[model samples]
Target: MPAIVVERLSKTYFTYKRPPGVWSAVKSLFRRERHEIQAVRDISFTIEEGELVGFLGPNGAGKTTTLKMLSGIIFPTSGAARVLGYVPWERHAEMQRQIALVMGQKMQLWWDLPPYESYLLLKALYEVPDDAFEKRVHELAEMLEIRHVLHTQVRRLSLGERMKCELLAALLHRPRVLFLDEPTIGLDVVSQKRIREFLREYNQRERTTILLTSHYMQDVQELAQRVLIIHHGQLIFDDTLRALVERYSPSKALHLRLEQPADAETLSRFGRIVRMDGLEAVLEVPRELVSRVASEILQSLPVYDITIEEVDIDEIIRDIFAGKREAGALVNTAGS
Candidate 1:
């Protein structure tokens, strides 16, 4: 059986509509205005044990709302979602002990207490065996490089240290499933890298199922092989990372450092120039004609150096939002 199963799951939020002005508010006291916003619309997917799936979407696209539903932080409006055979929204004790949820900006640790105290509280709450809890805490602290800071107050730690501690706190009971919502947000490069490595090691060692949501594509690229994309609360794409890249990023990038600067008209024949500054020009060339564009640029321009590269996933996604590309159509054509 799948570790996490969500079928026809939908969540609609009731938002109160308050009119502007004091008179309007007073007049509306008798009857309140409200509207239901469909945040997650009939989204269905399953996650097998040990699978790490990335949820991708723009801001206000309902990604966090879905995570909340799956983590028992909020109730869904309709449909079924089972995590390890227990309804997630029920927040059953057994289910709660087997899973963890870490939000990026939210803190699970006590602000005034030392980080270690927070873990101890969770240890009692989860009823972790004394010996097992001690071993796990030591191991996780060593792995996360937060052993020295365990006694430091949470409010005093840097963003990165606090994040590491939070991670350890969530894993104190060694959950079989993890829901990570932007767990690495707003950290320095070294801190982010450290957290990423720690997560990879944890996943490999525990074979724990992870469902992560992040606004930063770098996090998704580094950790998840399967990605589910949602737009406007709708499941728009579900596929392997390679498949998503192949379907959406059909165009290649060509960079040229011309010995002599060229104008728009002079470079228009090769492809759409996305970046033009000084002596360098970056073009978005169709994959089919990448070689042709390269050769033509080499033969025609006073080229210093030229290279071709795959367009980054971020740009491809931007193009999709701009109506410049469609992965669904691209995938269909490729399959045919």
Candidate 2:
């Protein structure tokens, strides 16, 4: 069975918009006004066991709201969701025992105490055996290279160290399904790479199913093969990373190194010049015309070397989100 099955799961919130003035607030005391905001709109998808799926969207795209619903933190307004054969919204103990949720901005560990104490607290809460708890903590600390800082207070640790400790706390019970929302939000490049490597290794060794949401495209590119893209609270694309690039990206980049200097005017005839320097130029050409343009440039210009490559994944996805490119449903099933 799929680790997660969500069918038309949606959450709508009712909030009121009031004026800033105190007089307006007093006037509205007798008559209250409210507005409806559709946070998630009938979005549906499924994730199979052991699959690492990236959930992507812009701000206020309902990514966090959806995660909250799936993690049983908040009840959905309508539709159904099941994680590990149990309804997540029902908040069953057995189901809770097998799933974990980690939010980058939120803290589950005690601020004044060291991570060791928090781990012990979680171990007790989960009813983990004493011996098993020790073994698991040691193993995770070593894997995350955080053994040195495990005894340090949570408030004293660096951002990366705190994030690692958060992961350790969430995984102490060895949950089968993991929900990670912006796990590497503000970390540096090196820190982000470390977390990704640890998560990848853990997923492989334990066959854990993970659903990750992040604004950083590198996180998705490095970890997930399948992706679910949400836009304006709607599911827009669901497919492999390769398929997404192929279906939505319309152009390829052609980089050329000329034996002699080339002027911008001369390069413009070949294709759209994205960048130009003394003897090097980068051109953007339609996918179908890339080969033809490359051949013409080689024959017509004093070219030393030329390489054709697809557009960067981050740029392609950005254009899609900005509505510069239209990407229709690339898969028949919403989730596979």
Please, what is the whole-model Cα lDDT of each candidate in the order they appear?
A: 0.87, 0.91
Badly placed stretches (over 4 Å) of model 1 are 20-23, 254-308, 327-336
Per-residue lDDT over 123-195 for candidate 1, one digit per residue giving the tens place of the 0 to 100 score: 8998888899889999999999999999999999999999999999999998999999999889888998898
Clashing residue pairs in all predictions, respectively, total 0, 0
| Candidate 2 to truth, TM | 0.90
TM agreement with the true structure for every prediction:
0.84, 0.90
RMSD of each: 4.0, 2.7
User: Model 2 off-target regions past 4 Å?
Assistant: 20-27, 260-278, 288-303, 328-336
> lDDT by residue for model 2 over 1-336, one digit each (tens)?
999999998889999778789988997897668889898999888889999999998889999999999989999999999999999989999999999999998988899999999998898889999999999999999999999999999999999999999999999999999999999999999999999999999999999999999999999999999999998888988889888887887788899999999888989998899999889899999888999999999889999999999878998888988988886765438344
Q: How far is candidate 2 from the true structure (C-alpha RMSD, Å)?
A: 2.7
